[model samples]
Target: MQHQAFLDLRTTLDLLKANGELSEVSGEVNWDVELGAVTREVLRRRGPALLFSNITGYRGPQARCSRLATGLFASFRRISLMLGFDQQPSNRALIEYVLKKNATLVPPVLVEDGPVHENVLTGDAVDLFAFPAPRWHHLDGGRYIGTMGCVVTRDPQTRQVNVGLYRSMIVDRNRMGTLIVSSQGWGGHWGKYREMKRPMPVAFVFGWDPVMEFVAGSPIPATICEYDVMGGYRGAPVPLVKCRTVELEVPAAAELVVEGTISDDPATYAPEGPFGEYTGHVSEIATPRPVVKVSAITHRDRPIFRGTLEGSLPGASGENSYMSSIQRAAIACNVLRNAGIPGILDVFVHPVNNGTTVIVQIKKHYEGQPKQIAAALWGSNASSHRYKFVVVVDDDIDPGDYEAVDWAINYRVDPGSDDIVVFRSTFGSALDPSTLLEHRQLSELGAGLWNRMLIDATRTWRFPRRPQWGGERFPPLVTPRPQDLELVRKRWREYGFAGWKAEF
Candidate 1:
């Protein structure tokens, strides 16, 4: 598919509107739990991306920023459009497109300055609350300013630039407390900074084209810069401008840019979390984490703050859920290929689990292939927060279909056989409520622990071949012959089920 560049939020919104995928909520809406609740309802209904203009506390003429955008990726259609598809594409198509684009890296082009520098606020003049950062959940610790922020940072030694989607909450006008998992891309940078005992320079790009959020939020390999990947998606180099207060570059026309430095100093840490997470639960506790020492705030005039209601609830999934489904599956497949593992036909991640469970469909090349898939995934950085439950099925099964997977798991998997494997006490998501509290302690363990599981739902090769079953190791699936199905199709009304309007 040809790529179309929508470099900024304004143009992206225009595209969304033109495609009838956007909705402008001109009526006054509260930025508290109310807006979040409304957004959830829309997500449940699979509605359009919202442009909230008349927020209750942010609509005044003197308001620093009055508009906000959310739910741009609540559906496959929106994500498909972002990928330059004229219409909604199947998950396989989406994954294939992403795999190709990820390999096509084009580094960003830096200009002297851009619209992000149109207005700059520093020192006492800076007020993070001036923008309509929302307390998306009632239990949220504070107004999260960086729900969708594409955080930009670099390694001190290698100078390798990284852009990631890490959550940040407003602690004060100039201080934002954030969670930086040691297993993530930004966390790797934080570790080096800790060793050197220096503050880590950080730049938060709050809003831009949807692709920024797409790549930043996924595991796109640490060696490849996200900006380069973004450029590849746009079919051109991303225009960038140097941040005023940090040695970082942000998209030139980003809606808002928050520049800061985070010290490893324990004294500067602040309490954060108890917010809704993508796993469909509230982060259990408020723990003191690294806080950003905001040095400056730069943006275009009347900037629109970007954030998302993070949790994916029953029948109400959020942006991260939709985006992760395609990217994580593609990334997982890529990981297996890179590891030289064979017969990885396709991979699928259910939106609800947000990549926690990766379903693999393979051509069944050899015995113990399921264990190999689980091992490779668990050993990869892409499995930091996901791939906790890896299910392997034969090529006949559709990984995307829960029913087919369930059927395969029931029949193909022998309960007492070597079809199930569990790797205990491995690194995983700290916010997983199922994990014991003691195991989830970041202060002590530096990361959470999970007992990962692998279910080999493929037909077992251990079974003896039988001539009665057509010389197969396992019995073939029971179904009517092709001639019988065609006969029924020709005489459908005779079966007295013509009221059911479907092909035989």
Candidate 2:
């Protein structure tokens, strides 16, 4: 029988704490840019997840920045812990588990009077500045209150639930300026509201289970409800509580929830940007954006605020911190599977940039057939619109094993013939340096349509050698005389091989 699911984020954190992966910090961390930078460095260095107890500049009688799960996926061991997976499991194995659960989605259960409703603020009493809104970078426009928040929405027409991870900037003590991409469903909702000349209803929830948080930020199929996906992720149904002011449901044990309405005036632009982006570069342009008016705020006592710094590629936060490429990879894999690609090892969309570069590995079947697989990959829906650079290799060439992939690329492919470039495709990445606003002045008009190269990096059939080399058949399958590995294990103590760690 499956184990009973965790009740909430606190329960999950307790499990993590018992496992020695979470560290409680009493450090009086400044909630300004300092905390953001420090937390990022800690995650980058592969330290334990931190729970900052004291946050400066917040006048509330409760704690701030109390919980954070960082570096949970930086190592194999931690990823295993997060997924309840065995240590030796490959990425493919983990993804298979994820997919299986995704298909068995259980809708969230509703409950009343959970931890998130312990405190309530409405109308004039709602002061977002009371919380420690972190000024993540030096050049940022202002403090951001919702870098870790998930915006919940339902399609006006279809009523299908959608959750988007958008950065919410604190425009004042009560107003939040939000930026969302048009490619996502949140953008679709905003468009619908504009067409009807109505304010867009939105609710932002923070401090939920890490798996639920990740699901909210993932690229789940448009047909899949994000809430149901979160339930699938946890291996059980999620428990939810209705919001006080908005007609939306949030995780029952969430630390905080803010309900609001999004403005739709084109002329009501703000001087946004100059914040550090995932490309590891500071942005220069200032653009108008939707301003969110907070009608109510509700939370658990001693709420936690989570912050992620944004910067250029491979810099500090942003792409790497947000795990955006993980979403891209998941989506790509799903597409590949639907296309009947067999023995897929893994799909990795490198961070710091958007889905520009995609690396995939699959177990090759038959001979001279890897190119057929590579061609399908080049034109696949997932790879076509976004990825500008794609590399296909065999399972022996692990996509994560960069050194081996580079070796395959060096050995295969005469660049002129092996590299195929397709042109005039839609490409819109906020972190991409080449991406610019189109002639319509609409940010969604998207300016980065150009050629994309898909390279056949697997071993080629062409020969400086035989018709078959390094394949399943080489030397009539020469077999090594077997010495019992079990015998060695039994005799290791006598051979002074007691050096192996006994912890396992």
Best by lDDT: 1
- Stretches of candidate 2 off by over 4 Å are 1-4, 59-76, 86-88, 311-327, 349-356, 364-386, 436-451, 461-504
Predicted candidate 1 versus true structure: per-residue lDDT over 346-389, tens digit per residue:
89998888999999999988998889999999999999989999
* TM-score, cand. 2: 0.82
- Candidate 1: segments with Cα more than 4 A from true spot: 486-504
Cα lDDT over the full model 1: 0.90
What TM-score does model 1 achieve against the real structure?
0.97
lDDT score of model 2?
0.65
- The 0-to-1 C-alpha lDDT of every candidate, in the order given, reads 0.90, 0.65
